[model samples]
Target chain A: MSEKVLMKGNEALAEAAIRCGCTHFFGYPITPQTELSEYMAKQMPKRGGLYLQAESEIAAINMVLGAASAGVRVMTSSSSPGISLKCEGISYLIGSDLPCVIVNMQRGGPGLGGIQPAQSDYFQATRALGHGDGHAIVLAPATVQEVVNTTTLAFDLADIYRTPVMILGDGALGQMMEPIDFAEVPRRQCPAKDWACTGTGMKRPHNIVNSLYIQPEDLERLVEERFERYAKIEAEEALWEEQNTEDTELVLVAYGITARIAKSAMNMAREKGLKVGLVRPITLWPFPKKPLDKLSATAKRFLCVELSMGQMVEDVRLVVNGRAPVDFFGRTGGMLMTPAELLAQIEERMGK
Target chain B: MSADLSFLHSPRITLITGHYGTGKTNVAVNLALALRLSLSPIALADLDIVNPYFRSADARQALESAGVEVILPAYANTNVDVPSLPARVASVFDRPDLHAVLDVGGDDAGATALGQYASRLEECGYRMLAVINARRPEIARPEDAVAMLRAIEQASHLKVTGLINNTHLCEETTPQTVESSFQYADQCARLSGVPLVLTTAEERIAAQLQRPDLLPIRLYTKNYLERF
Candidate 1:
């Protein structure tokens, strides 16, 4: 049996990153996500790793870029607002094809929104994390244990694709606690950082890490190549979990903390003989379109529940594509929809 | 209830304070619930102004439904980040019959909020207990634990009457871990001149130890938001 330990979601992420051999963490203090930085501040120094409380979120992310350029596993964490500040740096990392992890312990958004669990950054995280053509591999974990497992995978995915991978969590997942077994997490084989900008020492040509191109043709070609890589990632890495979808009339689509609440609603709807199921997207960027499309073949309808104002519902709608009706139920501005409220919505929609 | 917790005699007011991540709120919740086993008119006051997570006020519904009056700040369970102490905190002293348990904030900065009620707490002859988790990085050493206790005392303006050894590594905690922390706890107790009033372990570990001073408690810090 694996060693089981109870830990807060944020703290667990820090520990998992350490176990995954991440030696550098740079972040600024922000609500809900502060514990992640706090845990790093306490543990990183003890482990002889670099933990810097950067001047700002922008500085922290740039620091991550520098560390990643040096051929070492590195990460940076922030909340929604802080992530917004790090947008340019994120795009730079993407353009340079640097491997690093970024954690967004999401809080309420749209210019200094309150400190509460929110998924308002869905559009920002999945569709447009930064300006210009860029897409990060976004992994949304539903539990603390998943946070641990996915964090390790996020590092591997980042390295595998030479791109920044995001662990998009919210205040609830950051604050919540759960028992996790980290004993047997299989490490993936990543390509060596042969292109890293370590000192040349006259043995090899100097490697440059930059996101700038003087020629439009060169930039266009680079963009096309990056999209090709993204296409492969989309085809291979899209992940989701299905519950009771094998025989169900309605499939509930949600992610992160909302998925946990939706699970309770699904169970209640099942007890009421309502044939309800849930398809929780683990990788939000890939959007789990294949599984949802599969469920659309048999399910009568789909309901996308989220902490935002129906951001992910757009993805569900695109995938379902008139084969089945897609509806959205969401609560924004840091308001959480209760299980009872969700079940009532499910019944009302199904009854109609 | 375990035999070890029998020594708990309800005082007019009990204050629980400790370093951050030391399981003070957990201890406060367990103590309030255990005291409710015999004491009447129990009130658990959430005085935490430091940490946004794991505040006693978040468990208001459960505690109140169980007939314990819960006193919280104006923004106790809300997403508001302001640290405004409620006027109802003074009401706990008004009701002398109420066995009030104050779950203060973590560390000296958090404990500083308790300074406003220092005179009231002192006059009421309260028993302030410093919950110690040797696993916490800030107070992992005996000297660090002593320094934290003194800082909490200086900030709260209330002396710690006893030490509640609550050392554990969360879900990874084992009986051996609890047993090993005894020395650290003893060092803190001896240096601070505070009695080791209680030692807490999870129910399973507590059952294995059978120590007279151990208080077996169910974990309550996690899932605090799910209850709401």
Candidate 2:
């Protein structure tokens, strides 16, 4: 058995990235997510790795793009506002087919709303991570252990698909301390970065890492190819966890911290002789629709709970597609819904 | 397997300070709860302003429910970034019957907040314990540990009279990890001119060891969202 260690969620992710052979980390300091950059600043130098504190979030992500272009596992992290600043760089990375990990320790935001945990960036993360038709592989981790496992996986996924992967964590998940077994991190095989521009040394053809395509036909073909890859990802990479949904009338859909809270609510509702279960989406972008679609066959109602005002609820509604009544419950602007509050909402939605 | 914690005997005030990520808050929380078993009118003050994530004040409900008075800064549990110290901190000294525990923040920046209460802490003859975690990279060596201790002492304008070896990797800690850290702790104590008062291990690991000074503890630091 691997040793279990108590670690903060943000710090665990940074360590996991290091252990997975990430050599360069570029990031700016932001609340809730600063610990990750701080940890990297301390540990990276010791390991002969590069840890650069960029002037701004924009500068940090561009630096990540430059590092990833050299065929190394690279990463950057920030909170909601900072992530928003990196949107252009993220789009450029995806358009250029560069593989790198980006962490968003999410805080409440439309524009720096608050420095507390929030899932309000659901639309931004899933619908549009940046100003392009590109999609990022967004993995949401609920526990400190998952932060390690998912972060390690994030690097592999990014490389496997040659796309930017986002580890979407809220402030609560970043700040929380939990015991985790690091031995459980599953290692995956990543393909060699043959396309990287390592100064060819006048040997092979020059590899141009650029997203700009002058001809409309060429750009359209590139976008079409990326969409084909995304289609394959959507079909194969949607991951989720279902608890007590085998035979229940009501199913609660949530992710991240809200999912954990909803699980408690489901357990309490079950104890009260109510048929309630939980569907937690581990992959936020590849939305985990099939399992919820399967549950819609028997479940009489669906409740979408989030830390935002019905952002993920839209995805739930789209998946349910009128098969059952999908109700929405959320608390925006960094307010947390207690288990009791979630249970009350569930009970109310169930008409009990 | 209950090793004696006699080192905690009859201190009117105890200040817990250490480098960041040294598990000072966890030790302080456990000490407060343990002190409640024998002492009366115990107060656990949260003076941590550096790291916003883990603080003694986050466990206010548990400590208060266990009859431990919790003194926290204004909006300690909220997302406010202001490091405003509360007026109630002064009240901890008002009651002579109170056995107050100060969970100071980590590093010199964190310990600087303690400087405001230095006169009171000195007047009360407080016992400040420098918690050391040998696994943390910054304090992995005795020289680094001593440097950190000096930084904390200088910043807080207080002296550390004792040392507490709390060397463990979060969930990865084992008996060997604790045993191996003993030399680092001993060297640190010898160099800093402070007595190594106690060593700590998780209860499960401590049960397998026969060390007399080992204090077995259940980890109390958890996610704020986690319910009791």
Per-candidate local distance difference test? 0.87, 0.87
lDDT for each residue of candidate 2 in B1-228, tens digit (9 for 90 to 100): 655655565568999999878889888988888888988889999888877666777677789999999998876657656777888988877778889888988888889999988998877768999899877656777999999999999999999988989988766677898988888899999999999988878889989888778788877665334321
Q: For candidate 2, lDDT tens digit of each residue in A1-352? A: 2645567788889989999999999999988898899889989999989999999999999999999999999999999999999999999999999999999999887886887889998899898888878999999988888899999999999999999999999998998766666788899899988899998888999888999999999999999999999999999999998889888899999888888888888888999999998898999989999989998889999999999989888888888899999999999887888889998988888889
Q: Taking the candidates in order, what DockQ does each have?
A: 0.30, 0.30
lDDT per residue for candidate 1 within B1-90, as digits (tens), equals 464444455457899998877888888988888888887888899999877756886667768888888888777656668888889999
Off by over 4 Å in 1: B2-11, B19-23, B33-42, B61-69, B87-99, B107-109, B115-124, B132-159, B163-196, B199-228
For candidate 2 chain A, which ten residues in a row score worst on lDDT? A1-10
lDDT of 1 by residue, A42-132 (tens): 7899998999999999999999999999989999999999999999999999999999999999888789987888999999999887889
Count of backbone clashes for each model? Answer: 1, 7
Model 1 accuracy (lDDT, Cα)? 0.87
